[model samples]
Target chain A: MLAKRIIPCLDVDKGRVVKGKKFQDIQDIADPVELALRYNHEGADELVFYDITASHEERKTFLDIVEKVAATINIPFTVGGGIRSVEDIYQALQSGADKVSINSAAITNPTLIETAASKFGSQCIVLSIDAKEINTGKWNVFQNGGRIDTGLDAIEWALEGERLGAGELVINSIDVDGVKKGYNLQLTKTIANAVYIPIVASGGAGIMEDFYQVLHSDIADAALAASVFHYNTISIPALKNYLVEKSVPVRSVPSCQLY
Target chain B: MIAIVDYGAGNIKSLQIALTTLSIESTLTRDETVIRDSNAIILPGVGAFQDAMHQLRSDNLDKILQEQAAAGKPILGICLGMQLFYETSNEGGLSTGLGLIKGKIERINANVKVPHMGWNTLQIRRNKHITTNIPDQTYVYFVHSYYATDIDNDDLIATSQHGENIPALVQHNNIIGMQFHPEKSGDVGMQLIKNFWEMVS
Candidate 1:
């Protein structure tokens, strides 16, 4: 059976990881390539690069970062944020990313998902949804970095994205994003149960038990975290060790040496 | 020089980079002359089986591959490229493959998730050049919806469980196939690539 994946998401801006406050504020933690290499050595199953840059030139810089990271590490990584078109997807993959993730662009132009999937295979396209609860339990899709609610039901959009040829789904809850409490089990389970593809539970991952709950709950094939992993509050190897003790299958190199 | 087939399929970059990391010289070529002239060939792909076969056939690269394999040239196919070596595949319809190895690609049983996307431990069945020095149960990354089954036990090198015993690695004389992406599968993957490169070098 496939081992559950533990992903460390790096929110990058101008080739450096943006740290501090759930991906807010300008704080450079380390070079993206260096950070990715560290994670690779520490036994991270995969990595995700979220490009938070603004201009066209920055996209080039981000692609360069993706190339450097991809070359340095052997594990697969996904590049997300600001990917608007098929050309963007092409450039990202050409620069060495295993998969390109699209968020707001998929909402604005759903055909982007179809065209990308058809052109590059569905495995290369990942539909990333930023969901926030508007009513008691119903979640609405958010755009432009979780500011604009698109009024589309989260679950409905996920199914549509799958129909349009999305191979995997990444559900990130905006309400508990950086709270460091736990994953939104209700929101994640609802989407995971509905979709056949692998679902990555992002946001609100704090303790090792948090990952345990989501990964074993059949809600997430992978659990993604930024702050906990980025700041070393939870080392990937230690977390994997804990999961191993808890009987959760994780990809861990028993004798791995980390810097 | 090793000819890394450029069939307009995916994952050519990472394979090229993996070779570069090993200090091995390689050329990404679609030209038959280049492929015929090279000492070794690496067929890297990631996508639907039917579309990949169509691209190979349209460019006549399929015939070139057959000739090279027949001429005793060492060949290594990764991911979908490996699936294309079988007799046939059920993906996107019943598409024919290179038929170099005796097997058929079928959708992984519904017992597990589709695209079985993640890392899994390799269960080494035979000690071969590819599995040399690679520890038993060492995890390797995999991402695919279909797998090659009904393979002869003699050609099978290793198997990984994903609701079933998936053909992780296989070899028959000069031709080889790896179901997982060795290029993206960390240190163990790099070692396997180096071992393959050494076999021909």
Candidate 2:
């Protein structure tokens, strides 16, 4: 059986990790490679290095970080944020990234998805969307870091993304982002059902049960969290143990002999 | 030294880095002499079958690989490279493979998903050189749409369930194939790689 994935997303700015708080043991919290290896050691199924760098000049530095992380870490990871073109996708994958996630670029040109998926196989092209609930049951796609509403229906965009050759979709809820309440299960499930590809639920993961709730319920194939993992609030090994206890299949940590 | 066959298929950087971390020396080369002289070969790829076979044939790596396999030299294929070892692939029409393994590559007909991506536990069939030190139900990363079917039962070493018994690992004497990326599969995958290195050593 396929194991549910637990992913830890790191926000990088000017080649340094941002908001990497509560790690007294780690030598440098801003170092993305060190932080990534820490997550890998704790048995994270995958890692996402979201390049939140504001300047184009510093983007090269972020790619350097991606290379260092790829050379150091053994687990699979995705490089997301600021991926605007086919060249960017090529650079990220050439730097040893297993997958590249595109957001605002896919919305502006949607053809970028088709081109990237064709140039590089669809397995490496991930369509990441930032969605916000506008009405009782209607969700709209947001771009530019959740500030600009594209007026595109979230479900329709997901279907379109899959049709456009995106191998996977990351549905990040802007409303619940940083709220730490829980994942936008309703939105994630809707997208998962609408598309045949895998769906990764992002934003608002507060507790371990939140992961179990989203993954065990079969709403999301993977649950991605940043702060909860960065702050050591929920260690991955312990979380996997909890998930196993709850009958949710997760990859066991090598050090943890519970299996 | 190991020669990682480079036929312009896909990224093999991570595989090189993984070997470096293991203190194993490897060179990504398409040179016939280099590959023939190397102790072992690692065929790494991530793409469609027909295109990959086309590249291998164009580069004349198909002949070298078959010759090396006949010479009884160890060669390990990963993902699409594994699929290329079979006789034929139904990926993009009926394309011929290297015929190292008696099997055919077909699209996964499981109800779960198409690509069969992400981590999946391996159900070890029997103890082998590669399965040493690896526990049963160990998880490995996989990212492919087609799988090897109609393989010899004696060559099968392990399997993973993705709504069906997907052939995760196989070995026919010196030639080994893994449908998953061992370099990206964390500890368990590293163990499998180490075992391969041990076999080569």
DockQ of each: 0.61, 0.57
Q: Residues A37-137, candidate 2: write the lDDT tens digits.
A: 88888899999998775368988898999999999998999999889889889999999899999999998899999998877888999999999999987
CAPRI-style grade of the A/B interface in model 2 = medium
How high a TM-score does candidate 2 get?
Answer: 0.96
Stretches > 4 Å off in candidate 1:
A254-259
Backbone collisions counted per model: 0, 0
Candidate 1 lDDT, A59-177, residue by residue in tens: 88888888888778888999998899998999999999999899988898999999999899888899999999998879999986678999999999999999999989999999988
Give the share of true interchain contacts found in each model: 0.72, 0.65
Q: After superposition, how far is residue A135 of candidate 1 from its true place, in Å?
A: 2.6
DockQ of 2: 0.57
